[model samples]
Target: MLTLTEAASRKVAEIMSKQTDPVAGLRVFVQKGGCSGYSYGMSLAPEIGSGDWVGEFGGVKVLVDPESAPVLQGVRIDFVESLQGSGFAIENPNAVRSCGCGNSFETEGTAAEGSLPGEMSV
Candidate 1:
């Protein structure tokens, strides 16, 4: 079960209210990039193709693609702000390992083969 904190829910609602397009929902995908080999991606999108699992949480709609669902199960999304900066954070209980940047995760049971938790050195 994917969940969102109150702050995240409000922020998402505000962002969606400003959109003019007819959207299927926000999408959560894991990409290979950033200081971590995996990064969380959010998109206020209007379209969804097949194999997209729609997750409705915190009174909003979110799309989690099939490939990413296992890695993201029981994850909680939260928004954090400090005097220095503000951003979204993830509380992933399933992660066996995570990068320092908090963008990547690797699970003990099903990590991709040869995929490191952090990005490649330049």
Candidate 2:
């Protein structure tokens, strides 16, 4: 299962509050790309797709697709504010290696086939 820290939940709530569209929830997914091997992606989904795993935390709905569930299991998300800046941070136990920027990661036993180069989504 995936978890979100209080700070992360609050930030998601705040962002959703400003959206004019009726967002179903925050959609988290893993796509093939990044410096390490795989990258995480997130978006405000209008509706949950079929077979999606849904969880509620801090009064917000979080959605994860089946393909990404294994990779995201036991992951903790938090919002961090520092001198450099502020943004969401993902703590993934499954990641064996991650880029210095912390946007891309590689998982043990998963091949990095089909990965493309691009900006990470969050």
Candidate 3:
């Protein structure tokens, strides 16, 4: 399951209030690219794909495509602020190595359907 910290939930609610789009939810996806082997992408869209998993926390909605859900499972989302930054962060249990930017990851997770988990520990 995906988890959201209190700060993250508030941040998500704030963002939802700002968006005019009638989205199904916040879409989270992973693809094969980035400094690491994989990169995560998120957006608010009008529809959810057939393979997407939809979840909610504190009345805010989040979506993850099936392809990305396994890799993202058991992850925590947090909001943080500092002199240099204010943004969302992902705490994923399945990543073996993440890039310096923290936006990309490489792991042997079960990111594929019907496949054995990779060299990652979830």
Candidate 4:
């Protein structure tokens, strides 16, 4: 239930190829505790979890645990290289607000007051 840009898929595949362990796919999840309310985390999955939601985009497999499925719906991931730096950037429709760093976000029903300098309310 998410989309990954070609750049993101290629980047993930490149990184996975360097890992010593056999990489089955990418694991995407959300966890509590960030400047906002939740933060995004990703890792290379060596094996798929029993309850994970799996999808393939641009030939790259992505795994989303059950707990993160709903929150990650309609999300788009992209890899960007810029003078500022390069990394995976997430555009989440479920995020009502996001921290300046772009790694943290707050969903609807958990909206908080006061915005960080670079935070955006979507």
Predicted structure with the largest TM-score when compared to the true one: 2
> What is the lDDT for 89 in model 2?
90
Candidate 4 residue-wise lDDT at 119: 42
**Stretches of model 2 off by over 4 angstroms after superposition:** 112-122
> What TM-score would every model get versus the actual structure?
0.78, 0.89, 0.82, 0.86
Residues 10-119, model 4: lDDT tens digits: 99989988999898899998877789888889999899999899999888999998877877889999999999999998999988888887778988744653332234
* TM match of model 1 to true structure: 0.78
Worst 10 residues of 3 by lDDT: 110-119
Better of 1 and 4 by TM-score: 4
- Model 4 earns a TM-score of 0.86
lDDT agreement with native, every candidate: 0.74, 0.86, 0.75, 0.85
lDDT of 1 at 63: 84
Q: Compose the digit string of candidate 2's lDDT tens values, residues 1-122.
A: 99988999999999999999999999988987778878999899999999999999899899998878888989998999999999999999988899898889887745453333233335
2-107 in candidate 1: lDDT tens per residue?
8878898778887888888887777887676655345678888788758787877677788887767766788889888999898888888887778886767666
Ranking of all candidate structures by their lDDT, best first? 2, 4, 3, 1
| Better by TM-score, candidate 3 or 1 | 3
Cα deviation in Å at residue 121, candidate 4?
A: 26
Query: Which residue pairs clash in candidate 3?
Result: 108-118, 108-119
1 or 4: which has the higher lDDT?
Answer: 4
- Per-candidate alpha-carbon RMSD to the true structure: 4.5, 5.1, 4.8, 6.6
Candidate 2 residue-wise lDDT at 41: 93
